[model samples]
Target: MSELPMTVRVDGLPDRVTIYEVGPRDGLQNEKTVVPVEVKAEFVRRLVAAGLPVVEATSFVHPRWVPQLADAAELMTALGEEGRHLPVLVPNERGLDRALELGLEHVAIFGSATETFATKNLNRTFDEQFAMFEPTVARAREAGMDVRAYVSMCFGDPWEGAVPVDQVVTAGTRLLDLGAGQLSLGDTIGVATAGHVRALVAAFGDAGVGTDRLAMHFHDTYGQALANTFSALQAGITTFDASAGGLGGCPYAKSATGNLATEDLVWMLDGLGIEHGVDLGAVVATSTWMAGHLGRPSPSAVVRALAG
Candidate 1:
């Protein structure tokens, strides 16, 4: 295993940043095409080979919700023997049951910070959503698995407009109290500016949530993902979620677009001389291959600019 840098600079930037590769799960979940099980497994394999330390393998949500990732069982079985840090998404107890049955060691649960988004995306109110997930997260932790909770619409929600930072922090606290070891703050609608990003991170810190237990998940709806990531770095956040080729968006959030592209994030990290243990050229090639499978050009500017 490669040893990643751990030094925290005086300016609050990390010597090394951890990239949580979410293309296989979050990225492909929003795709209209049904990616083959073998293809999804291959995508995971290529991402790990390209040196991403953590890759979200698949989501165990019901097929009725996300048909594209319905083959979660088959895909996990294919990669069951691989020794990699692959986290699967488990929406509730049923989803957690499926993941636990597959013997997954790391998992992520999704939630929304705004009440409107929570009701629309999860079909549950704020309290009900946490009530549903508490047992699932606790059970996973009891089984010796690490759980990550994702609080979406952390900055702005299409239905609610601007989400207060305090509201986001409260949701994050609930998730962490549910036995989730880490919380991922998601800009689901991509309305977060660099200033918003900085303020949110600072607010979380002020609420007693350390940057060490937080990750950033951004969308590019307004072309602000990279800039927001820069702000996150300055706030001492070292982990980020990026999608290869920028494949996913929230179907419920109509204004949302694809995620922060892995290639684009890598370009910025490279320019900053940060140590991320990822091979930029290899990631670009993987995204290009996936674009071919999707029958569309990659939405990533870095991929288009480089592959051209």
Candidate 2:
């Protein structure tokens, strides 16, 4: 592991970085077997107890598309009245309706930065997906609900490699203009390097998008998520999305793996003296519990080392 910079200036460090725990939704959604509703709720509860401000609880997409999240409505109902922001994925109008019916206050919409990914993931062209989100975004805003947009394959794509920087900026700008309160740039396949992270952040900045409205969602496919994250931090971003036990994978991209581990991120933040307000010990315990339940070792190196 790289040592924390000893003499780095503190002025460029963000005031704080908001870690959005996506274990319950994005993590569990990729599991081969159906995790019980109680298990899902317990996982979410543990994350909340660990002081996560935003927890993506579930996705309201059709069961045929993602059988893992077939119980989205049930999960939302089970996690009733949590004080923290719990957002669910809304793929389109039908998903949005289900989310609203459950009285959800926050929702997330997703689009891909690459044309091939957009077509494969959403079964539509990039323009089509954007147009589809138009009414849904407007409706969510009118209902006074917070909306977040995810631009997947922001760094690279599995089928279509090396996404252009200009393409990512355009997609991000469109989402922000469409009433997305925040935009999460997803390194969906974990193919991003520090150079890619720096370049993309620069692209967003040049396009007049503030770093405050952006978040980094990286997968550790090549063990580069943390390094890329540091590059993003230097580029003025403050929000990040992580998963417990590093549990998540891209359904559309088969080669992709879990996200950057929360434990690892917290450990890094602690070394840098960054304030995340998250309990690293508690996060490890939760990851351990979930890993045992799933019958697999944690993907987080920090968690494994700490356990030893």
TM-score on alpha carbons, each prediction: 0.95, 0.95
The residue-by-residue lDDT of candidate 2 on 75-170, one tens digit each, is 878878872258988999999999888888999999999999989989989888889999999999998999999999998888889899999999
Q: Give lDDT per model, in order.
A: 0.89, 0.88
Q: Give per-residue CA lDDT, model 1, range 1-308, as digits (tens).
A: 21222333345567899999999998998889889998899999999999999999989888988999899989999997672257999998898888878778898999989889889889999878999898998899898999999999999988789999999999999999888999999999899999989898888889899999999999999999998999899999999999988989986888889999998998788767788998877888999999999999999988888887
* CA deviation > 4 Å runs, candidate 2: 1-11
Candidate with the greatest lDDT versus the true structure: 1
Alpha-carbon deviation at 66 in model 2, angstroms: 1.0
For residue 269, model 2's alpha carbon misses the true position, in angstroms, by 0.5
Clash totals, every prediction: 0, 0
Minimum summed lDDT over a 10-residue window in model 2 is located at 1-10
After superposition on all CA atoms, what RMSD does each candidate show versus the true structure?
3.8, 2.4
Candidate 2's TM-score: 0.95
